[model samples]
Target: MNKIYTGILSAVCLDGSPPAYHYAKGFGEGASNWMVYLEGGGWCKSEDTCYSKVQNQGPGMGNSYKKGNQTAFDGILSPSQTMNPNVKIHRRGARVFKAIMEDLLAKGMRNANNAILAGNSAGGLATILHCDGFRALIPNAARLKCIADAALFIRGKDLPGAADKRELSFATIVAFHGIDNFLPKSCTSKMDPGLCIFPENLLGDIQTPIFLLNSAFDSLQVSSCFFQNLLLELNSYILCIHFRTTLLKTIPEDHSSSRGIFIDSCYYHDQIYFNPKWIGPTSPKLNNKTMSEAVGDWYFDRSSFQEIDMENDFPRDCTRDT
Candidate 1:
């Protein structure tokens, strides 16, 4: 674990602990390439929940003290050129990102040839929220892009014209975290800051190239909508269908060629960090290419991948052991 011990950057986490990240330097042709992955652990929308997460998850989640001395590089961080080809925290996550990037810039990332910023779940949402800013940080890199895994959290319409409970939750989080000040001005200027937390609101303004990896039937999102809306078991199937349709419609129609998307039919969430789901035998594929392949191709400009699995309109079980 590389802890940031320099100045104010040291105490950036919610608990005022030093924020840290694990680094695995590259070799050969991969030396100039950099991959910055932001980890996800669902957010705490209230102070009570924040305290609970700090206690329950220990220093590993928001504090660097308990982090391991070393961690194996797996999944997208794999060192194998054949496998990886390339390439957390806090209620104060926005600050954590800044500290990590500053540390990297100081430690030789300024000469990076190519760079990627990626994350899953809440981290995925962070990737979306911080996409353009991350690129601006490494303006010298020849190529820079972002990847969001299971990060698309929409303010879904569980019932016709019903108030969206999910939006309210996001609003609470935004207000609690004091994140309105950090949201993109382009989005906040046009809509409520709470809405900006949703990728649907921020996607249009992001100037950097990005690859989106999401399950069309994202299990966590679907379940959250079901329970929060208080839908009866008899109407659960109808809620599923409606939420799926809403998710599909919410994705913007206008996408430039540089953008990439891989929305599969699996009822899963956060696939990028798991070897089995990212590139192994059970990895979900579209156009006969796994998620890792598609992302690599897009990053290297080998091909454009914008395919969505239209094979099934509803969710299907494509679960794989990690």
Candidate 2:
């Protein structure tokens, strides 16, 4: 594992801070494969929030953040170590992502046998937004795919914040991260920047092979108190399940036909990014397959898997209560 401070400085952090990423060189059987994982931290809706995020995260990587813990990779990012969920959040996501991919290209990543661009949470969304650019950079690779973990957040009219607030929040992120410029032209040409950045509206346009690794019951979408209130009145919480179902509907018809999903009936956000939620006998299971098994099978094409635990093992709203 090596830490590379990007020499290409044009790409700065999301908050105008310095951009950087840690690299773990693949070896032996994996040497010919390139896996670029974008670190995930939730996005900031405004300059004020972005600034605050930087201040909190900057120190975690500094004096107290641990110069000794070199193996920071977790889940699919690296096979060596597990990431602590409490790790500091870096708000300069878009800049750091661009810098890393650019740096990798300069270092011969394009010659790899195949490539996997994966991310968690907000980084998952970044993976979606940058899927095409990644493939184009290494068009010669045998296969180039993208994986997004717990990144499918509901946006637009369906967002919990309502239309007006959602518009302001999305607009701020687009301006803050310069996301509008990368949005699929098909979406942006018809919708405003705010609406175009939402995945539900834009995922249909992504051409690169993508595998969504998220939970059917992503707790972050709605607060627990709110969900509990809904259950108190609506015995089934059908509305919540319906919303979750719609998010999965973003997958293309072709992908759906082939089968590459690990969505489960877990009340968590990002299981693939952390070990505890993804591994072990007691972990959430879909058709008896763990998160890693499903992802591996899909990325390597070992098996055809399309699992929606909500529809099979778990009863409707069972996850909402869990």
Candidate 3:
């Protein structure tokens, strides 16, 4: 696999270090295939600092800190724990995401036979926002696949050129969201006002297969439900599965629950708002079994999915028209 680094608005500061990308060797090893992962949050300077601030703020502020210094919490009913210490935390910023995508394309990722875009939380939103650019940069034969965990509820209008860019017309689009959290600030001005207008604008044009996940016990689940409702109403070709039951609740009590999975500590005040039962999974499979499994399967096998015909379903520049 070929790898390249694209600079975002500025360099990402993770644990006080610059951001970097790891392109796994595969696509070029056999047949060409590509997979990209995005993370959630409002573009923190560094992973450690981001977590430290959350810890300082306390649990309820959306930054849950497990006792073990884990950055992520398990999706199970147990108390939240620390993320993998060895795992490299990338800067979660929109510009960083754009740079990554651009870098991948520059490295010939766009020419692959298959492509997959995956992310948790804000990263998921970034994938959706950057899909159009991927389409423009890659060859037509390259299949596009998306795996969004606790994602969706994003509005295309919020993106830089969402007004003019087309909704991501991928072969498959899968999304997941917690039942307790609300849409991120990027999605709306306030939590109560309702759905972001951006998702509405692109709903009709999305032709990929969509999978939805939510827990009944989670507050964010309500927002996921609202998102599902809008997609269904738009007569979209989305496949949604909602988990009304959950054994655990996510921690760090903020809108970007999954995004804060890498912090080492939480502020005392934030702890009051955190749900101890929310823990990060030991493996990606355990995080959210259904979504993780589906994503893995999609990433390897492109033949199982079908691509969208952009000309008929989506407007050339719906973002601008909306």
Candidate 4:
């Protein structure tokens, strides 16, 4: 893993602090293609929530570039200097992303022919938020795409009570993070920036090809589709069904061939980036294709594609032991 210290970058995180992203230089043929992944933990809805977030992350939001020590990185940031688990600081996502790209441009990403800007969970949402910016960076690239994993928070019919509270959270986030200032002006102009932050509103403005990767029964959504007050537990199944329908409908059909979607019945959040879920004989199979093969085929334009799993055919519950 190539570590680009935040101190050398142009942007600082929300707290006026520096945070680094774990970067891996592509190899061989892969060298010409770039993959920039955003790390996601969750979001900060209020000033207090933001403060609590820093506290939870300890000094330097887990590891400090100021310390001059190789703090461990995991998940997609894994196989690094060491392994240590830490919570993510959400408000800083967009800025961290901008800085990462600036450093990559200075390296050799400018000569790349293809680039995949992707992330899972919160990272997935960030991929959508920053997709346009990334495309602008490589205006001459032959192909540039965005992949959102389990971050497509399914929008649906009027789900009152808890749903209203969730909307409130969105409002808080927009103000807390100054999301309106950077969001697509057209989207925020027509509606609240809080609502504009959703892919449902921003998808139309994104000119880049996008791939949506999610689970029919996303674990994270089932638990907290709303706030702690709206814990649906297992009964959130209804919500998932409606949300998927809305997501499928929202994707642009104009350039249908350029778009791709993969949703399985597995009860998991982010899968493709993790080894067990990506590939291997024992991995979760969708039409005899592992996550890696499906993504490769779609991103590389190897075949026509769109996969959705039903509960009856593969009603398999995902267990960590698998």
Candidate 5:
């Protein structure tokens, strides 16, 4: 087995508080290869029940409440779901994350050659957002990749920008989701302007091999199919896989399980991509997997798993075809 070493880097967002990235040292170590895995953009924390933690922590500590206040607060406060209305504040976090990633790559802590850029949910969106920034910082040819799990929200215009730079080549993009839910419903509705549409618009910009996984019962599956059809229509190089399964219904009486539902659906931003076996068959309703497993499966399933393709250019559909 290939030996792997891991390091964690904390990036201070525009808010000045640091967010972290788990950087693995041994990825492509033998051949000077590297990969960057960006976490999703929901409240940036790594725990199963982040919202509950926020509620238990009782605000003030991490934006759940104003500092110096003492009150039992509802833990559902988020930039997206809130009406206070400061859109730029939310974007600031993404910019800070990009800055930190660039700094790490330039400092040689992250290898530029054979680098795989990846993320789930909001993290997946960030991967696409930061693609151009990564290229500008590291001019050397590197393999850019992603594993976006049910992440299709767009904050602003749906057009591809620096992240879609032509110089960068995608190794593959593996997107996963359930059917009943994918991105927030607001994003899909034409009535809402602030909602995201980038996920749908991104289909044409993706030029490399693409794999999409979806559950039959998931609403996100519908959105995934929409994008897949778009790619198929254009004859783009995208490979889609659908995992058809019935979602287990949860019992309302179970409190512990109710918390789990909130964790899976809300806090993590729907990045949970796990196998049903590991989570156990008993809790089929809550059995979930991580993005890592899904991405690994996609790569291994490919015919040319051993070699990396660096010559492919960004799809011109974003410019000419659109």
Candidate 6:
């Protein structure tokens, strides 16, 4: 955590504020095991969006100046040995990723025996994007894997010939962030770098094992509508069904046997490490295992979880009150 400066690495935020992170060294038997979590705060596809974000949120999301000096660690990143173990920023996120890992290696991640790179939403996409590169960074580590939670933003036709807003947004983000160079060459070599940002386009080539925790009816990608016209509402419902089907089919057939999938029919976005959604009874379950249980089982090689919620065609409310 020392001897590395944001100014030296130029890993500053969009507003040029210094980047920051909350890290707790693992203790007891879990020492030498590392979990690198990339916090997701969506993306800024254009200059206007970025500007609007700055206006509304100050530099909190894009700058470390507003971030708390210490963040509470719970769930997977928790220091509780009995419960279990593990565990931000910028359009300059790619740069920040590199700098953080460099610092962690200097701080002892280089000695890591087991490592998991996990992220949610946009950060989950980042996990998939950088999985292989992260593996290469620690070749000596005995075990390394990645997890992408609710980041499987697919590219597909909403209607017969409708333009995909998600894909267009990604293209704009590429142009806005100038992050084309950071995209995986395996994907870029085959098509436009902008298309490569989609996880579906890049998953086929990823060497590192990855576990995907997502929802068939992802709340972010699919929205609820209150239409007065019955026909319009019916049309919207049909589109939702098509979207769900497209997402299911887009996930590869798991030919390599290295992918761990858990796509429930929940109306949630990011559901990785939060206590209730992660491990409690109210948490959405597939094959009798909660998200946290499934992830732990996959990470430790206890079992391979690759089940989709075929029963529910609609998104079920799985959020907990607490």
Best candidate, TM-score: 1
lDDT of each: 0.78, 0.66, 0.36, 0.68, 0.35, 0.76
lDDT of 1 by residue, 87-127 (tens): 02346666667778888887778889999999999889989
Least well predicted 10-residue stretch by lDDT in candidate 3: 264-273
Clashes of each: 0, 1, 46, 0, 18, 0
lDDT string, candidate 6, 126-232, tens digits: 88988998899889999899999998888764433224466676888888888888887778889887788888798888889999999887777766211123324
Root mean square deviation (Cα) for candidate 4: 7.4
User: Which tens-of-lDDT digit does each residue in 1-322 have in candidate 2?
Assistant: 3334643344445434355566778898888799888777676766556545544553213222233655577666653312323223344445555666767887879798989888888778878888888999899998778888887766525535556555676777787666676678898899898877677776777787787777765766644412434644766556566656665675555545233677776666776777756675545667877778877777787876777665643223322213
- Compose the digit string of candidate 3's lDDT tens values, residues 1-322: 2322334336443322334565665734645777776545433334464556444442113222335454354555334323223324333333445556677676777677777666544455455445555555665634665554444343333322222322221101211112112334444444322333233323233334322222222223222323434433664422112222111121212222112121111111111111231222322122333233433444455223211111222112111212
Alpha carbon deviation, residue 107, candidate 2 (Å): 2.6
State every prediction's TM-score relative to the real structure: 0.85, 0.77, 0.40, 0.79, 0.41, 0.84
> What lDDT tens digits, residue by residue, belong to model 5 across residues 1-322?
1111122133233222334444445534435666566554344232223333343432112233345544454355533323232321211343345555665665573555555555565566655445545555555644444444444442112222213421111101211111113333443354222122244434334433333321222233222323434444764433212111111121112222101111122111243333331132321222233333334544444322111111222221111111
lDDT of 5: 0.35
For residues 1-322, what per-residue lDDT tens digits would candidate 4 score against the true structure?
4444565343455444566566677899788889888766888777667656565553225244343445376566764322333434446556666667888988889888999899988889889888888889988888888888887775443543334665666777788877678888988789877787677777777777888888765667655663242435444445555544554665555447567777787767888677877775445667778778888888888874677775433224665445
Ten-residue segment with the worst summed lDDT in candidate 4?
Answer: 80-89
Q: Considering TM-score, where higher is better, how would the candidates rank from best to worst?
A: 1, 6, 4, 2, 5, 3
- What C-alpha lDDT, on a 0 to 100 scale, does residue 187 get in candidate 3? 41
Least well predicted 10-residue stretch by lDDT in candidate 1 = 80-89
